[model samples]
Target: MRAVMNAILNVVLPVFGIMLAGYLVGRARILGEDSGRALNGFVYYVALPALFFGSMADVPLARIFNWPLILSFGGGLLVTFLFSIAVALVFFRGRFGEVSMHGLTAIFSNTGYMGVPLLQIAFGQQGVLAAVITTVITAVVVIGIGVILLETDRHQGSAPRVIARNVSLGLAKNPLILSALAGILYSWSGLPLPQPVATFMELTGNAAAPAALFAIGLFMVGKSLTEGMREVVWISSLKLLVAPLVTAWLAYSVLGMQGVDAKAAIIQAALPTGALMFVLAQQYGVYVQRATSVILVSTVLSVLTLSALFVLLGVQ
Candidate 1:
């Protein structure tokens, strides 16, 4: 019991404290409303990429390509995603765009911002490696499917080939994905990073955790649980509860993932819905209120859920 309490205090509080500071700052209007956007841009375009690249650059190809971790995490996400779609269709009578967004909200764990930082704090660089792998999976597979579905819904008569091409191009241009791949390639070459470059990456990457968490709090400032309370509860359950359970089962029982790989996969699965889903909701003007509610509610509730999970996973 004492160990559990310590884990909560030592790991969870600090992460959420930074986020709360950001939220308070935003609420006070100390900075412009766009402050979150700017911070997120820095994290996304600069800090996160550097972190991913730097982490992956030194890892061996064998460790980096852990198939069990990949399959377990990816399978869990796919299952949750498909289940969310079914719920959307049957319960909400949602169309393609709305269902796609719903699925995204359920499966899109905030791996980039919250997951990376939390894992780094709890388990260090090994945890971060697991996070980077999951981030890539979410960015590439989950986001790709969501975008394709939304685009197809929006452009009913457009050519399938064009939509596929556009989505491919967008994913190709994603900085996180590009950086991870680049790091893998560099690692494959088996060349050490020069002192200057390594120093630069370390300095820049160090900023990613705090900046990303603060950005989440800032982004969350104005959102509230205004409408779609039932749907909000449903999707939040999937994201915060069911997803993690499924991932845990797969990682431990089915896929034989042990140690940090299993723990990180489960933790990442339990993360609150990513803010990117809200961005996509706003952009497509589909399920906007529900998306906002899911993000906000899930984030607040995750404080308890994640704390319990840390205890269960024996994270210290």
Candidate 2:
């Protein structure tokens, strides 16, 4: 009991507290309207890439290639994604681009921003590695699929070669994927980073967690829950509940994963819908309102869900 309490207090409270602070700051207009955008840009372009690179650079290539972890988490994510797509099609009668966005909102966990910080607090470096792996899975496999579907839908009359080229270029431009790949290559090389370079990465990467969380809070400032109540509830339920359950079943029953690896996978799975979902929706002009609602509702609900999960997993 004491351990559970400690885990919630130590791990969960601080993470949410920072987010709350960001929310307050944004609400009050303390940092001006552009603060959130600037912070998010910094985290995405600089901090997160540095963090991914640094985290992967020193780890052994063998340890990084945890197939069971990949299979369990990726499998669960795909299942949730497909289920969401079915719901969107059968119930909402959504178009192809809209259905794709619905699936994305269901499966895209905020692993880069929330998971990394939360797992690092609870499980340390091992936790970070788990986060990196899942982030890669989400970024490369899930987002890649969503982008391709959206592009195909938008450019139905265009040649396949054009759509493929566009998707390829977009994925290649993602700094997170590029940095993770670079780190893996560095790990494969088995060369140590010089002191200056290592120090720079550490300094930059350490800023990712707090800045990312704060940016989330700031981003939520003007979003309202007044629109799309039914869809919001449905999407939020899939993200906050169904995704984690599927992941837990796969990690424990199917894959036989145990310890921090399994726990991290489940926790990342349970995270709120990624903010990137909203960005994608805005970019494609599909499922925009529901995306906002899911991100907002899931994030608020995740406080209780994640705390309960920490206690259940004996995180302390």
Candidate 3:
């Protein structure tokens, strides 16, 4: 019980506080509506990529190449993706675009921004390394496969050029994937980063998580939560509970993952849906409100869910 309490206070509270602060700032008009977008861009384009590169650069290729661990994590994520689609088909019925929006929200997680920091705090540097690999997977699947599913119009005629262009652009600009690839190349080349450059990246990388949480808080402050409660709860459950359980089962049984690898896979699987879902919905003119609500609610609830996971996995 004491350990649980400590986890709540030390781990959960700080994250919630950062998000809460972001909410307050937005509500108070300390920053305009666009502030959230600005902060999100900064985190995505700058801080998160740096953190991923810095963390992965130092890790050996072997640690990042755990087939069982990757399988468990990827399988859990894909299962949740399919589950979200199934749920959307049933509940959403004719609302195909909204269904796609929810599917994206329910499946992908902020593994780079939030996952890296939370794992590091809970389990240390080794955990952060594991999370970097998860981040790479996320960047690939969510932007690649996930987007393809969401954009495919069964009714409208397919534009192969548009699809190809989008996929190509996604690959080119995906910072997390690029960082992982860069790390791998660097390792293969047996090149070491200069001390000053590495130190600079290290400092900035360490600040990414807390800043992201705070930005979340500020971003959500003024938004009315009344519009999307039903979809929000259902998707949040799928993300926090169903995904993790499926991933845990697969990690232990099918994949035969154990020890730290098993724990890390479960942890990544349970992360809240990524905020990128909302950005995507906004871009494509889908159920933007529904996606926004899911991101907000799931992130908040993940505190309890993640703490429970720590206890169950005996992280302490």
Candidate 4:
């Protein structure tokens, strides 16, 4: 119980507190709307890449190659996607497009922004690296395969071109994928970073999480909580509950995984559906409100869900 309390206080509370501060700042108009956009852009373009590159550059490639951990995570996503689709089809029979959008939103996760940091706090650096790889998988699949799944129009384009463009574009700009590539190149080259450059990246990278959480908090303040609640409940359940359970079973039973690897996979599975869903909705003019609602609510609830997961995994 004491250990559990410590995890909540040391790991979870600090994260949420920073997020709350960001939320308050946004609400009070200190940072204002443009500031919020700038903040997100800074984190996305600058800080996240630094963090990813820094973490990966030093870690051994072998540590990031835990097949059980990778398979467990990837498998959980596949299962969750299938389950979400089934539920959508059964419950939302007519609204295939909207239901599919909600389903996709329910299963994917912001493994980069939230999952990696929280896992690092609870587990360690190795967990962070593993989670980073998970983020890579998330970006590639969710951006490409997910988009393909949600696309209902046959006249949208040639399927091959659509997929190729998505995959190409996703690989180009995503910090996680680029970082992975950079880290791998650095590792293969066997070159160490210059002291000044290393220190600079480290300093900037550390700022990413707090800023991100704050942005999330502020974004939450402006949302229509009441209107979004119904979708939130449904989407959050699929993300926080169903996804993790499936991941746990796969990790423990199917893969015989134990220790930190298993824990990381489970927690990643439970992460709030990625905010990318909302972005994609806006890009494609899909169910934008429902996607945003799921992202918001799932993130709020993940504080509780993740804390409990930490306790379950004996994080101390």
Best-performing candidate as measured by TM-score: 3
lDDT of 3 by residue, 18-109 (tens): 67777777778888777766766666667666766776677667766878878999898888878888977987664666777677777787
lDDT of 3 at 165: 69
Model 4, 1-316: lDDT tens per residue?
Answer: 4644454345455656876797788788886577755666777678766866776676566666768887999899889888877877876553555766866887788786677766776668878777877876676556556555545432236587775676566556556557656866786677887888789778997887677666666666767656857556987898999989999999999999888888888888988776556545644556766776676677778878877877787776
Which clashing pairs does model 1 show? none
Which pairs clash (backbone N, Cα, C closer than 3 Å) in model 3? Answer: 18-214, 19-217, 22-217, 22-218, 23-217, 23-218, 23-221
Better of 1 and 3 by lDDT: 1
What tens digits encode model 1's per-residue C-alpha lDDT throughout 199-254?
88889977877786677677667776566788889999999999999999999889
> Where does candidate 4 stray beyond 4 Å?
89-170, 173-176, 271-296, 299-316
For residues 13-43, write the lDDT of model 2, one tens digit per residue. Answer: 5656877898899889999887876777787
Q: How well does candidate 3 match the true structure in TM-score terms?
A: 0.79
- Candidate 4 clashes: the total is 1
Backbone clash pairs for candidate 4 read: 23-218
Better of 2 and 3 by TM-score: 3
* Residue range with the least summed lDDT across 10 consecutive positions in model 2: 3-12
Model 4 C-alpha RMSD vs. true structure (Å) is 4.4
